[model samples]
Target: MTTSLSAAELANLVTAVPGVRGIEPGIGSTLRAIGSRIRQQDPRQARFGVVVEAGSHRAVIEIGIDGSRPVKEIVRDVQETIIRALSEAGEHDDASETRQDSDSSGVGNRNTPQVTVRVQSLL
Candidate 1:
């Protein structure tokens, strides 16, 4: 069985990375936040800048960097951090109840979401 991943949880993890500034707010996220407020939901919980596509097991993350590290290094760290967190969440477990081997890039089995990190700005 596949476990559901929460974008808010993932956002928290990403933001905790040393060189990460915060999630970059895009138009979609902004609109979602507004809609969530209208619906009386916490916009912060509703509109974390991470987008998870569960069907395809993919996550697109936009973040701002502190500019204290190389962009490539920071981006790679974000991807690895996300993959690691998902793996620990049992998101990469196979149908046979076995853990799959993560590749060098930290991508696990089909159940694991492929993480894409985009740096939107330098803080």
Candidate 2:
């Protein structure tokens, strides 16, 4: 039988993703709360926002960065990291989660049920 993830577990997963830099301690709690109200999207992180949508099995993610590194690179890194960490966590019990840019130019990623990262004037 498969097991679902708790909010804390989810946050742990997020922090583990590569290029994620750091996740707020409340990542799991915020997602859990926003997941109910936001319906399609939620946001997190301080400097760089990392957005995620997670269902029982699958999840989608996007990372927003201000400068320094290209947004495409950041998104790719987030996608790879999230996929790797979550897959390893559950042994690929869930379908392969898809990661893509939400907007053109591939700078921003999509907002999802699980998480959304907004860069409030990136540092």
Candidate 3:
């Protein structure tokens, strides 16, 4: 069996990363919500800027960040931390829970769930 991450769970994961001030609303999400409304569905709130796309057994996380930290470094750190969390969940038979190490770029480490981080603002 595989573990699935909820939007709230993902949000918590992102916020826990060091230097991450907060998750901003993704630019495209607003447009998507408007489009969905046209289809007669209630407008859904953006996933705290953390868009999660789940595949057969993994998830792709896209996050928007607002903070006064180095953009590249913060992004990489977030990716690594998220990947680690997912990996841990995959391991524990309890089927629950949740970084970036220097040796690896932490981009596509386990190739399980891919992460993309966008810097929206500084401080």
lDDT for residue 112 in candidate 3, whole number 0-100: 62
Model 3: lDDT equals 0.58
Give the poorly placed runs of model 3, Cα more than 4 Å off: 1-3, 31-46, 56-68, 92-111
TM-score of each: 0.68, 0.39, 0.59
As a whole number from 0 to 100, the lDDT of residue 39 in candidate 3 is 75
lDDT of 3 by residue, 10-120 (tens): 668788877787776556544554554577643222254655444433433445555556678788888887777766655563333322343765355553666667666
Supply the TM-score for candidate 3: 0.59
Best by TM-score: 1
- Give lDDT for model 1: 0.72
Where does candidate 1 stray beyond 4 Å? 1-3, 28-46, 91-108
**lDDT score for residue 70 of model 1:** 88
Residue pairs that clash (backbone atoms under 3 angstroms), model 3:
67-123, 68-123
Query: Over 4 Å off in model 2, which ranges?
Result: 1-32, 35-56, 60-66, 92-123
